[model samples]
Target: MPKGIYNVPEAYNEPVLSYAPGTKEREQVAAAFKEMYNSTVDVPMYIGSEEIRTGKTRDINPPFDHKKSVGKYHEGDVSHVEKAIKSALDARTKWAALSWEHRASIFLKAAELIAGPYRAKINAATMIGQAKTVHQAEIDAACEFIDFLRFNVEFMTQIYAEQPVSSDGIWNRMEYRPLEGFIYAITPFNFTAIAGNLPASPAMMGNVVVWKPSASQMLSANVIMEVFKLAGLPDGVINMVQGNAAEISDTIFDHTDFAGVHYTGSTAVFNGIWGKIGQNINKYKTYPRIVGETGGKDFVLAHPSSIPAQVATALSRGAFEYQGQKCSAASRAYIPKSIWPEVKELLVKAVKSMKMGSTEDMSNFVSAVIHEGSFDKLASYIDAAKKASDAEIVVGGGYDKSKGWFIEPTVIETSNPKYDTMCTELFGPVLTVHVYDDTKWEETLKLVDETSPYALTGAIFSQDRYAIEQATKALENCAGNFYINDKPTGAVVGQQPFGGARASGTNDKAGSVLNLLRWVSPRTIKETFVPPTDYRYPFLG
Candidate 1:
């Protein structure tokens, strides 16, 4: 390869396909959906160059229709985890030693695959697997994941191009080295894009990754592996495993070679991982980097001066889309009294009109939660709201699990600002609205800020610039991803780098250069053109 200064192509956000009527992409995706839905795939754990299949297995079913078998994934145990670790270590040296441009090329090709041929397949898989509708899958699996791959490659090259300032007689250079040991990527079930990006971003920075995707996300996760393989990624660069979280995490965290963990899941699990790493701090050769994105009780606050239609639409799309499973989904809303009546009427109408069913049909905006546990938890919350005097179901509060884990998109209007439903992360299609006095905007803003432990995402809709400015400043520390006159959900990769502070996450801001920086440890190199003959300083003379 020629050694010369290089620059990556200008990164651009991938356009989301509406998948509207009579569109070619819609037809292709619909066809793929039908094919995938009718088929039952067998998924195996990918370790090194081998696809290992364990005797122990479990069926993978779509959340929308549990009776329909999408696939079956082989479950690996501790021994398999060991092999995965060994495989990663064995491959790290050669993989990391390769030139940065080569690494960039592989992921760039992967992005193209996602953007073109695999787009329909991946989106279909996401729709079937995660119960996401066409629009959600289009934005998530197709656009966001593709953005991650292409932009991450560009970001990687940007990182490699950065050099230190050189002094009079010396040339200074900086190298962004991957972590000494392997990285552990623990992804969640919500976003297929996040699942792929978590591991791929680190691996692109010359690191080996042991990725453990959520059990619920196996269908789309397997597709991601296939796409990576097609991109000519080397074997053992990213080892895919699906199994018991506790067993696998314990095994991975216990290993001496463990360098870091890139996690996106719950707060409890994140805390447990941190505690375990702390307990084993003395055992590792180097300090392990922990980059995580966890839970969010994301909110939307509409001011008295805001337009009711726009505010209602924001809540409808932000909360009900994908059944409010996204961490950044608006589960809580703080509306002022002046527009409360109109906002409620419009919101109730919109929510009532939303179609909740299988993702196979593009008409349905809402679908089933991930599984029974989630369904049960959400159902319990809805029941509690119904029984309690402080909370009232304004639009929807229905659930039916006999067919599939389906819960109607429920909105609870609560008088108690500090109600359990208002603060807790339901992680379902449930939005609790807390109405406050128009004069108490500042106080209500404080209530929104202090109500939840999470600071992931929050939005303020206002026609008044002064009110918007105040909300923006007051809620500055409350949400990492804050939106103005927009919903809290749908944070595009480059434009709005996602993550939050406090209980939300480490605020590493995924999809940005900041997140990529966490995967690397920088080292400086200096080359001297002239040497002092006598090791004496001019100050001494």
Candidate 2:
């Protein structure tokens, strides 16, 4: 719909079936295809019984099963957070009083449910709603969230076991306590696992949560809620609300009872929320906790000694995974001149091999971008990059939206580091390749830190110890999560804490104990057998 971008071809409107023809196989595939297509059209899921008049709507285009309805949400203004806060406040008392074992039990149960019966439904919903390949959807709906559930339970147990302090004849212990009030969780559409963990973390820590999921991810959210319910999560312990930003913000920020906010989205929105909280800082009974992860223009650096084949593989996954929609997706590549030719050829070949088609096509890797609005933005960036400098479109750089939102996996070779595409966060299937001279590697590293405002995730590919050390130090302040010879995108739950600094995020790395820590407040409870009357220790005396 927007200028410069094209729509998906009409030929891809229907699901492409390649199974052996038979009554059983035909019926099964036909039914699956039917369900997939039906999820594309917008369907409303009301939360609080208020009519949402916001004109915002999803485009249920083809390639996506047109008959499949997109989930709609009717979330109205919570002019007063008083009720939601009260709900959470009350819920927290009972939730927190439960032993760690109880909480962990339910969490594990939820994970089991997710992996068991809900897997197919969740996978299907994600693939249709987000246009994810079957494997990608399965990874998100089943694997990632399941991992988060199991990991958080283990991590929270460890945090609880940490002891405070003890002195001669005096023993003191410190315990983590949940905020007495409600926690508001605002999640992003990119990772549904984020949606599950953001609210669940705080809930597990004995705080009640109010979740505001991204509209694009409502279907996934619904499936997650189902899992939680099946796990026997207490009624009203977690509430899902969907609405425009204004209504949600007005409700949550203005509430005096809100104890914390967990958010992941654009920097602008995060900053705006921060400012509002600052303005009303004195209105709250307790200091509110704020944790967020925002945007990123992650980088992938290739050294002279780096293998050309490995670099290509990493870049290909980083640049095009989820259509470059991931916050940590590598958007920039700085390849040394020595390995530039080899890296370039391999990368181009790898890009060419990526299959582009409907998600139902199991082999198709490239699917439609989430919606038309995003497609338009991607097109603008590509066009602006072309006009602003001598940037060349290396591989693919167009869109076709006749049936659904689809963009070719695009790569651009730019001569100028300051090219708009190189600097900006293009959350689409687009990558900018910049070749650098080996002699000027240090200067290039400096340039990387300087040009990009985001520092979420960055990687370097090299075996040289000195080179790795130098680059690491130089780019130390560049990314929150740094990698060596690894793709920045596929961050594991327990191993690599995912998040960035600067414009990228609040540095609250998800999938780690750090994220769970953000949900709680540690309080020291000192008990002495003799009730020390004087505030003097044996050492001081």
Candidate 3:
């Protein structure tokens, strides 16, 4: 341990780069995307110091250009998962024993590497791999990821500095230790930032991680591992495995050394993992920590006093950005009858004008959904809405998977608030709006709250302070992160620590100290300056 205490640099959100048509970032990212798209890179499982390339491989194709191949990733089996767990446990001793500052420094270096050298490449990788537009990629893959690292380092320092209040004769201190054994990180395909964070956060807190990135996100996930290696992250500290989710999860869940899991994915998968852990509760050396941010049927409720344009813009951006794949994306909306006409007109025009195609086209606001399954799901929902008596496709409802898994930014106007499209989480560019009576604001609030099982994110559009206050109070538990005038989709790192409760997640706000605290097991130490010969305390005497 170092003699002197150290302070980490102040953490700030990484500035989002706007890849304007004439900008240098635009040109650079486009070039990088072109090169990466044309090239064929092979990704292998990273276990300990070795790169294990299983013969079984899956080709990576961009969702927008499904026929074109960008790369291929090797598939690992159950044995590989076992190897990954073993490697993590083996590395945990040395990794967890290292000075906290050194651990902090590594991730800090990763943030800088991402911010400076690898910004465009990572953005390009996310764009190609996950079908994100340049702006979305810039925010999620580049800025938000950098922010998670830097902010997490700062949060770690804060956690360590939180010492116990010492008494006069006794010196008290607190030690934030990593969880015993190893951490399993299951990351999603939507955000490369989340893919990096789900593993990196635990590791930063001195835990070893066995990471399983989403199969569809392998292209960017590969780049993340490369960045970690370049930043001098030890090999076994974060072992990457790719294979069947069930096989890998079962192997991890059964391990005696399985310490915890940091996950971001479907609620069903999380529930299954939770159940598996419960069934194998007695097999673990320690009780495993379960941290996850799952599915969301996020909402947008408009008050009668709200501006139509503002509400329209909020719905357009909040619901349609990134093809509405975000857990916090506005999937359902409750609009008052007063502003429904104007809001409908503005929203329709906006959705109609949104250009949809490849991420390569900077002007295009919308891109393909992540994969064919997601595309099919969205298509089926659209088809269902078209046929349903309670719902009608308002403006954009066309979907074509011929050249790409492209779905037009769609809006569904529903007569019934309880309609399937309004209640269900259609994780696509589909926003279902239900117009309610202007006088029944409180009733609508109740309806919004009770509509969905998720409470991830929601937004309330109201110029009236009283209505805003009422909505805030009445719809409190409906959303973990609630927006007053803005869209609920973009939750910045430090500014708005994101996560939700209910079926959505544990509500452990990521991008804050709250999330970091989950990874550590704190111990309080109290030492007396002088030892007493008597065994009994003064009170006992």
Candidate 4:
């Protein structure tokens, strides 16, 4: 295994696997390093600061493997679950009593810590652990997460400053309050930023959080806990327990103190948890808040006047980044037949030029999918596409598993909208392109709507004002977030709210004040200058 640069032990003298700056060899080096680490390392790494099973001190694997890592949490028999809830309940009374400013200060300190000494190591670990390219890892571990922290603090500031007013002699005041019980954060593996938002948002609002991170990205999650600790957050304020899905769900759902669940995963899991919450509704002191962001079959509509180069760049990045594992990743595109040739040519060139390999290779723009399961699923989609009469692979459709779960960036062209490739969510580095005649613009819009049950995100590329306007209005309900002349994947922290309705889980958009609202409950407090001296007034008379 390559020696980790940021937190290498003094006695560790192995040569570090250095990537050639800006060269594709960097991706090769990254893949090589990951392969070595996964195959050679024998110990299971803990996802939290303290090992739950052994209750011993241990150094974390610098570049942990996602697949081989096991859950550090032991099955808490019924008694342990009771103790966890009691701990949270005991902590909440004091945590909720603290001023909002005091709570926000800890998040500010966390942002500072992430940007300072912890930045490099965290970024490196994310790259190795998640198979994210160095640039992608930096964005996930540093830029996006820091932006979320800053945005959350700013949001709390605004919420605190705004005052309620009354016109007459009466006075009314309203303020947001944290749920008096524990908040559970069930996060995904695609983005580390999402992991931070799940718990941190509620934590900033003075709620105790029991975070259950995705099993695939536990190391990245642990690094987040380290940052939170360095920020001086009270230990019990944020507690992390790592376990498998069944174990986690059982523990979280059965625990009476689990007041709220913020989730991002498959729709099935979301619905299952919702059912559990409903079944156990009366067991809790209050109703639990359930917020989720599920699957999305995001689309991109290419008008005839759309610039080929720009649209190609947008589509390529949106479809292939993180191997299209993100919920918002572009999976389908609607192109007018009038400009089909130009669009196809540009897309083919773009996909062909993309360097795909290990993330450590600086020149490689695309990295491996997270694991073998994703690899198999992506391959199945490609095989299914190969048999389609109207569909053709425009770029890549091959996979190699010797070193890592690497698949070639692929593009498929199909004239039939009914093709399964165009209709289903292929969450991988595969794009399905559908062509429609200009006369069928309205029909194509309808097809896009019918094809996706998810209304998460959709984009339009058009230079004409009327075309952009028409498409925007028509597809408005097609996505929670709509974009023009931009990719759907790069939704900013403060600017864009990032969730959708219908099958795409709840519309509790992350990264905005709306999401923060779901984590809290508003309370009304009224104070009078003097007590009412007379029980009877003019109205009573």
Candidate 5:
């Protein structure tokens, strides 16, 4: 019983606040960071209308200062995951039946809450829990997440507006119904925005969700749950559970009500879940939707005509920002031999200039990796590169975990184009470079395309129009989000729909209508004005 057509507020990207010196945002975030850092919080699993704290708890430690505990989150077992699934299923009917505008209003309110009251708190949590610099936290936990909520509302309305054309004697319409069962949302720790978005996107489409956030991100994830509760999201609409990933995934995938998964994690993990879903396909009531944005060995390829200074800046920022943990972070670079000396000099200087420490100091451009495991992995890679005959550590081959999991921004120059660092994903503050001959621009593009199993993101820098065009065409299939004269990271929500094909992911393009379409099953309705009583007469004539 809807009374009138409703239009959501005009959606726009939330303005990113510069937490610069002497600014109000700077003071607010610093205060919040200090308060959260000094306090210890206990987080529990959310199922239905209850907060279930299974006394089994794990401490939430900051990567930049591992010995200090900012909080602890209650860990769940298989039973807790099962309860979360049941909660989502039990709540699905009422949630899906709610008016679409109501759903839109809830998310829009969440956006405002994030933009206004919760901005500093969420950003500080990201800084403490995930080790992101203030700028990184601002762009991610604040602006990008706000954009995802507001723009998704607009995208939903657009999807609802799409209808079939009616003939003169008939009427036609389309009804987009939520999937038959619940959604399983698995998010990563690299970006707090992604952690919020993976579940919020599906829930915005009226599908109930069972979300499992990464353990390393519990602090910021708890803030997101708070925002959702304040924004008036109903109980059990999105049940959040944290524990063993395998146990949670197994419990969800084996259920007959398993409808779909929205995942952002390692390529290996995504593939593993896809296999599990395939094995359980026979048990499901409907074919499940699988959407994921996985790992990336993203690249930056420079033409001989490219400016050395610009290319150097791109690599410095793209490879070291957030310690290069981003899925789209530039892990590999192909620089022309003509400009190699200048680019190398500038890049080395930039890396040497960055100060790495805790995010409390706004001047620190780099911070620790997420955990000890990442620190060890990056150290092993740096050690291996040091001994490799064809590779040399150009700069920053040092690491120290005595205080925190800090790895220096390292660069490896390899004579071999297929060196392990160039082809593999390091997912740390490491960049590998291959100096190709300037005349071999086309050949280098081919090499770049063929180098990685991933096709998530890549950037081409060039001053020559013809070279740019040629590189663009040659590298089309290698990057889902291709950038011209820029770094591969920092993709905005509405401006660049992000995802990939091949080993990267399903390329569903999260942030656009294409992604939202995956959550609904449309039914076409056509009513004839004249009954088909004379149907046989037309055939006879």
Candidate 6:
């Protein structure tokens, strides 16, 4: 047992690996991907210390090549969900009573494993499983997740160090107690980091969890479970389940032990989850905590004084990375009319130059979208833009589903600011451009602010300080993570502390102490050095 109150090492963002040509890291990840691709994997749902394999299973494959089957994951029914929840609740007392430092060390060890021995394997799984490029996997599965684990340990100390001030006669201590029950982590498929962080972050704070990964993300999610085991995380502390989402969620949410939900996905699904929780709130032991990051019509605003080249770069990268599935993807752009021609020319050139293909190819910048449904949805939007008089496809608007679910990085120039593409969250490789008069900068800011029902992320580029200040203030409530001269996507773990307001989320600021605070209830311990023998006030005397 460690004796003294200790401080965690200084936290820093994990550096992204370039995986350039002839690099050892590149070779390692490639080898891992090849081995995993050639072999079939079987994943089992975890309940307590047991690995329960239901005979019912579903086939999974890479989005880039759906014909190639890579693995199968067991699917359970409502009974398994009930068993998992019961196991979690049964383990909650032991988990919550564990010392905070012991809990923190488990995740810190997991981070080191990710940064070292498990790096290539985890990145390989993400690239093959989620259709992420090597660079994308490096940043997300390898780096960002590592940052979350390491920084979350440091954040635990911060939460613990916060104590109430004591007077001369008393010694006051603050104890941060983990929630009485487990958390339900509803994770998305776009990023392996998020799938890992959603469950483990709360687990690090001593709260057990029932984690449900996106059915599309099972391959990498299994790898995360493997790493946690190697890190010596006790069994029953975190349970993984896969099955009919409706059956599973209904079973879990209806349980009285359900404590909280950590979700990242569509607004509609999140709203449904919220409604379910509300309807069952009276049955739960405690008022469950809800922390979610949902849909966004994120935008990029460029002033006339800004460089067209820089604006073009941000749009190209922001709107298309991970095939624009990010919650912070720049789906809309507000450009000044004075610079529209130049910006359009540069943006079109960049979009046309991007390569879309399988992630196995190192040079390919974009890969196939996650599934056929997303591809069909994007193709419909592109066809609609082609027919509409106000909307024009400037660069690329092609879709081919013969081999993989591929949609070209498309740029839609719309005359109407209120166009569906401008105001809606298409969540694909579609960027809508709406040009406004440069003189009415303030009005443009307001239009940008008021256009979207979602306030997740937005960026502004301007050479003039006054315009920067004006736009920043005007669009303050419009974005949770605002950027100046940078793309709205790729928020670092500790530095950005990302979340949004309004429909975007509760703005709990994941990857920060504020987020960890959600899992713990603070109790102030007041100790009196001198006991008052008489229970009487001065007025009584």
- For all candidates, the clash counts are 0, 23, 0, 3, 0, 0
lDDT of 5 by residue, 315-361 (tens): 99999999999999999999999999999999999999999999999
Q: Give per-model TM-scores.
A: 0.99, 0.88, 0.99, 0.87, 0.99, 0.98
Q: How many clashes would you count in candidate 3?
A: 0
User: lDDT per residue, candidate 1, 235-290, as tens digits?
Assistant: 99999988888999999888888999999999999999999999999988899999
RMSD, candidate 2, Å? 9.3
Write model 2 residue lDDT over 1-541, tens digit each, in one string.
2343222111111122233345443344346545755654333332222223344455433334434455454444563234445556666677888776678778888887876666666666677667777667756766788888888887787787788768876778878998867888999877878888889988988888888888777677777887887797886678776656777777777777778999998888988989999999888878999998998898999888999999999999988978888888889989888998888898889888998877777677778888778888998887776675579888887777777777888889888888888898879899998998899888998998998889899999998999999989999988988999898887777777788888877888888888888788898877667765888889986
RMSD of each: 1.0, 9.3, 1.1, 7.8, 0.9, 1.1
- Over all chains combined, what TM-score does candidate 5 have? 0.99
lDDT of 3 by residue, 230-338 (tens): 9999879999999998999999899898999999999999999999999999999999999999999999999988999999999999999999999999999999998
Candidate 4 Cα deviation (angstroms), residue 114: 1.4
Instruction: State each model's CA lDDT, in order.
Output: 0.92, 0.77, 0.93, 0.74, 0.95, 0.91
Residue lDDT tens for model 6, 319-394: 9998998999999999999988988898888887888899999899999999999999999999999999999998
| Model 6, residue 342: C-alpha shift (Å) | 1.3
Candidate 5 colliding pairs, count: 0
Misplaced by over 4 Å in model 2 are 1-71, 79-83, 532-541
Order of all candidates by lDDT, from best down to worst?
5, 3, 1, 6, 2, 4
Error of 5 at 202 (Å): 0.9
